[model samples]
Every structure is written in C-alpha cells, then in structure tokens.
Target: MPKRIPLQRRGRAKPKFRPRTHKSLGKIELPKQENTGIILDLLHDNIKSAPIMKVRFGKDVMLLAATNGSRVGENIMIHKLADLPEGSLVCNVESRPGAGPKLIRSAGGAGRIVGKEGKLTSVLLPSKEIKKIHSECRAIVGRVAGAGMTEKPMLKAGAGFYAMKAKGIIWPRVRATKKNAVDHPFGGGGKTLGKKKTVSRHASPGRKVGSISARRTGKRRGKK
Candidate 1:
C-alpha cells in the first residue's frame, strides 16, 4: 500500500486536539454509596477549563470528565436513582446492562436523560445530539464543573506557549509560506508565498500545501 496515508489537518499534520491529563493527585477518601459507586478526587488536567472526576465502579477505577459540581468524596449512583436532577453528568449509560456508556464523554462534556419512552431513555448530549439509552443505565447528577473556561482570552503569545507546554505541545506555529521555496509549497522570492495556493490531492509531501483538490477557484459571480 502507499504507506497508508496519514490524516492531515488544514494541509498540515497535527496531533489530536485533546489535553494531557494528570494521573496522580495524591489520595482522598471517596464518597460511599449505599450500594452504588462514589465520586473521588476532583483534579486539574492539561485542559485548564475541563476538570477530571475520579470514580470507582464495581472495583474498577476510572477518571471521568468533571461536571455539575461533582466534588471529592461524594456519593454518585451509577444506575437508576430517585431522580436525575438537572445539569448532571452521566456516562456508561447504555440500552443494555453491559453495552457501556458510549456517548458524550469529553472534556467539559455532558448529557441528560430528558424523557423516557418505554425502554429507551432520551439523552441530549453536549453536542445537542439526542441519543436513546436505557432507563436503568445509570448516570451522575449535576453539570460538568469548570464552567467559563473557554471564555478566558490567551492575551499574549507567551501565555499560550506556556499553557501548551504543560501538555508538551508545540505552540505558535509558523506559516508554511514564510519558509524557503525548497521548504514549503507556498514559499520563496517575495513576501507572498505564491500567487496560486491550490494543490493536487496526489501531491508529494513538500509540494502538498494550500487548497487540495478544490473543485472551483475564485469567487463566483452573482446571478444576472
């Protein structure tokens, strides 16, 4: 095969857009549920705004996205509770007992069991996608915490650099056109990379820059 083409982002290769999470956060007592699971430590991850929630499920331990003020040592029921209060964070909620929660599990992500229809329970995810899960699948109540994280401005390039450094990421990328012609497709002679910015889908690595395989070029004229 042709080296199994790697995915590209905006004509360039980049890493996944997720934060690096910290695993160790010392030790803390977990909340005790009568017969259910309990939420453990609330810690900070590489993603400044999206907090992490540690919980224990039937001897298996895991870290979930912190939401709805899930605090340390709090009783969290993993299945069918008296009532799922508004702004709760739930996961592993499947139609079948062991299907496993498969939706809306992300940083600053959440879902709610809005309505019930016989066996299928309607859950509106963070993306506003409606999914049907089991009534007894179980979820945690309360919105994922760390609200207003995205509202903060980067302010300066240095601030952004240090922030991404915590996650071991390279920040403040340079434009490809700024390099020499031998370096990037848009590179060279004048301040402008090139008058044209389109490339073919089968272009080689060095020449594969700008609009790839675009069907049309230039702005379209309005109807006469």
Candidate 2:
C-alpha cells in the first residue's frame, strides 16, 4: 500500500507543521498618517531575521522594522513615496495606498526608487523586479538592519535544525527519489526519476509533486 506523501500531510494542517507565532510582538504596521516616531527599544522576534523596533508616535505605540543605524531614542521619519526623492532607499513599502507596508521587510533588504511616471512610482526591488507603486503609498526611509545575518555558516546540522524549527519549517529535506517507492511518486528509481515530473496545476494531491503547471520543461536551447 502507498503511504501518504509529505505534501499531503502538510496540507492537512497538522500542529507540527504550523508556524509558531506566539512570540511575535505584533504585525509591523504603518500608521495611517505620516508621523515621526522615537525608537524606544530594539528587540528580536523568533520568526524574523531582522530586529524589531518599538517606537512611540505621540500617544500611539507601534512595532516597526529596525532600520540600519537605528538606535534607542532615535527619531525616524515615515514618509510617502511622493515625499521621497528618486534614488532613495526604503523598506516596508505599502503595496497600495493606505494599505500599510507589505514589501521589503527582510533583514538587510531595501528597495530603491528609480523613477516616477504620473502617479506611479518605480521601485527596484532586491530581486531586480521593478514594481510600480502608487505615489501615495508609505514606506520607512531606510534599509532593514542586521545585514550579513545569513553570511555566517551555522557550522553544524543541529544549528540549522533549531533555526528552521523556530520558523516551523521542516529541515534537511529528503529528495523524493531518495524515498521508497511506496512513499513518493519519484521513488523506486535510483538517482534519476526516469520520467517527466511536470504535472497539471489541478493534479491530485498524491500526484502533485514537481514542476506543476510549468510552461516548458528540460534545458533551453539558444538560437545559433
């Protein structure tokens, strides 16, 4: 009899696979109105690689991504895209006007404002994608702090395991071909699957292992 695949089990929403979010301070949200805030403290959240800042803006207190050179008692300005000049670096940018920040919140990440056309502002993301955002969208005016956090090697498998556990991600993933035939679709083969792995986007759970709904498969050939 075939056993349930890892993908199927993960889809079942078991507690072991669920992310642990109880330790999170709160969502990194921007205020509706642009306001200057003072960083009261810097703290770490288990699920995040970047340090978080507790800031007070008037009577309202909120958590925000810690920017490079952020320090306690330091005042920071949160501004809209229209207010920032071109070539400025920003993080935690809102995806839409008044929607709050939704991009570039990763540690050491920042998006550069490259150009503007009418009401749309062009932001160059770290992935090299140029996204057009509304000029009214707000963003923090700095790069996320804790650069080079991933540059250091864990040095041990145990260290890697704990790090993944904090984010509730399964570590040391076993290849499908490495599993037994009854356990995985690509199993029973040696190192190679000996078959095309692409499947339809609407394939059944047990048959949805690899390259689902791919536009094309195999190595690309260049024109001579």
Candidate 3:
C-alpha cells in the first residue's frame, strides 16, 4: 500500500497589536548648522527645484533633504525629519495624528517632502520619483532614525531561538499524523474521504434549501 499524506492542523494565532508602543522624547528646538557634507544628488529640478543631501555619519552616508539655506556640498543638520517627505501625499499611514509630521495627499501616489521653495516643496515618491508640492502641507523637522529601525532580527539557534519563541513568532516544527480507514471509509487511505459518499439523487434537478417542491406540494390547476 502507498503511504498517505498526513493532514495539516491549525496552530496558535498571533496577537493583533503590540503591547508596548515605541516612545521618544518628542520634538526639540535646535540651532541649524552649516552644510559641510558632500553633495549627494538633486532630487527635483525644473518643476520644483529640491536636492537630496548626503552627509557622513561615521562610515554611513545619511540621505537627507536640502531644506531652506541648504545646497550641495553643504553640511547642515536636517532641520526637520518627517515620517515622509513634506509634499508627499500618503494613504493608510501607520502614524499618530498631530504626533509628529504627517504626509500630504498626492495626486499620483504617496511621497515624502524633501525641500521647500516659497509656497511649494519637493517630494520623493516610493519609485524614487521626485516632484514639487505645496508648502501649506504640514511637516516636521528631525534627524532620520538610524538603520535597523525597519530591519527585524532573524530567529536563529540558542538565545535567538528562545527569544523568538517567547515572542510567539517561532515554534517547534510539527510532524503530520497518519490517517486510517476508520477516519475515512473510502478507497483513499486518509482521514477525510477522497470523494463524497452521500450522492444526492435529485441534485441534478436543482433543488434548493427552503424551496417548496412543486410536484410534491401540488400546484393550483386552472386557478381552481
């Protein structure tokens, strides 16, 4: 006899929300510094001139917007760090309102504000597409969080395994259980029968639930 495939079982469900929220000291006022970093690249030109500045942080290159009084080869602290770029239009954002900076609504899609020009601002989209935006859109200034902010740790052997296990994100591998004739009394050797045993004779007639059988109930003849 050939070996039968084991049935799959359900596992424990994961929690929908995290218990603790990430907290920061909030926004602080600080003096603007001079631009002394290397020129990265221009984000937006013609439509709404805005540039993307790259500054050296240790060995890492931090990409920031060249906001007011900023230019290429200038070392200026990103006066504002928004959840997204200033003129960016976003939907389904995972941010608290009036908490930090919010994204603006974009005609094509979501983006981030990079630089400002009078009543207009520059925005960077997910596709790396840069464009101009209106200044009326609310924005916030701050340094971008360090790398690894979006990267999750991998579950590995030993301490990493136990840590993930405690978080309910990792668990032991389970083997499938064998099924027998008692579980499924059909030709197939498995728990659930390969085919339905109770074949309805009248199924072809298109009978439906809660429907009156005209033949059995009898219909009025000639409005009698």
Candidate 4:
C-alpha cells in the first residue's frame, strides 16, 4: 500500500475576532517599496520591490540592500573587534573564511554581532535566535529597502484579484463543508460527518481532511 498524505482539518489557524463597539476603522494598507534611486542589472526587473542599495561581495556575486547611510559602493568586513556596518540589508553571514552565509536572509533583516567567544561569533537573528558562527565571516550592511511595503492598501477586490493572479494562486476558494458529500471529504456535513474533525494519518483520500495524523486535540489546560 502507498503512504497516505496527511491533510489539514480546519477552517484556518487564525484567531477569532469580536465585533468592535466603536466605529469600525477602515481597511489596512500594504507597505511601500523603498527606492534607493539606484538600479543593478539582475535585480532591476525581477522582484516585487528594489533594494535600498545593491551590496556586493566581490566582482560577480551580489547581496541584499543597504539602507540608511551605507551607500552603493562601500565595503565592510566582519571581525572580532569592531562592530558590523550600521545600516545595510545583510543576509547569509558566513561562519568563517570559507563557510558561506547561513543566516538573516530576508527583507529588512540584519544580524547583530552580539559577542565573540573563542572561534564562535554570536549573531542575533531577526527571529531573536542567537547563533554561534565563525568569527571570520562577513555580513553585508543595510536594512533591505521596501520594508514598509505592507503599509499601502489595495482598497478594492479587483486589486486583490490581480495580486493573487500575479502569485499564481486560485482565488474564490469554497469550503469543503459547503460542498456536497460526493465532492469533498468534509462534504455532506449535514448528514455525513461534521463532528469528527480528525482523521488518521493513513486515512483514504475520500475520508481525509480535518486533523489528519493529529497527535492530540481538545483544549489545552494551564498549570494552576
């Protein structure tokens, strides 16, 4: 028998909201892209937004953006004594001379060299995880441009449709419970099965969905 793929069993893993008593606020806007007034060859037309400054390691390879005052053609190195460059979009900081960068690879992301202990350099990730890496590795400078891209709002359904279309995701998704039993696993909820929200890891395709292969369910109790 072939292995069964686990299915998710829930509407969504989102929090429920209570209606606001005060006047409802308008919709939220997306963020704005930071334009550094400079452009590079490969990064010009590919991504959602451009970086603040194009950071490069050597002749060929390119790195993330450098925000603040770290300009387009400045060089900074990682070491034990001095601090890292003040404002740069740094990512994949190497561990040692030969070790490649392995951390902080996102927009508006940068690593702080917390301290050094022997051969290991403690780097604070964007997620607050402190990683110990080699001290000789280098980190680019700058917070990526366009960190505030989510501040802007579409304010229209058509805008959202185009956005989803650009990402190649299917819009207007209908729920399984809303479907007939013949169509989906959670179908026929009125008669088939609405109470059972969890299924085994190896459930057949027709009976999947819910908390498939769930180790545990129900309310979590707090320690008194």
Q: Estimate each model's TM-score.
A: 0.61, 0.89, 0.25, 0.58
Model 4 lDDT tens row, 121-146: 67677898887876555554445445
lDDT agreement of model 1 with the native: 0.59
The model with the greatest TM-score is 2
The candidate scoring highest on lDDT is 2
- For residues 1-224, what per-residue lDDT tens digits would candidate 3 score against the true structure? 43322221112232422211122112222213332345454343221112334455344454443343445565443223233454443421213322323332121224556677775656675568765644433332322222232355554567555544444443443222232443323433555545543434454222221223333343567855
Q: In candidate 2, what residue range of length 10 has the lowest lDDT sum? A: 28-37
Model 2 Cα shift for residue 64 (angstroms): 0.7
Q: Which ten residues in a row have the lowest lDDT in candidate 1?
A: 1-10
Clashing pairs in 2: none
Question: lDDT value for candidate 2?
Answer: 0.90
Q: Quick one: ranking by TM-score, best first?
A: 2, 1, 4, 3
RMSD of 1: 6.8
| Tens digit of per-residue lDDT, candidate 1, span 75-144 | 6665552256434556534445444444544455667767777766778887788877666565555565
Error of 4 at 223 (Å): 6.6
Alpha carbon lDDT of residue 160, candidate 3? 53
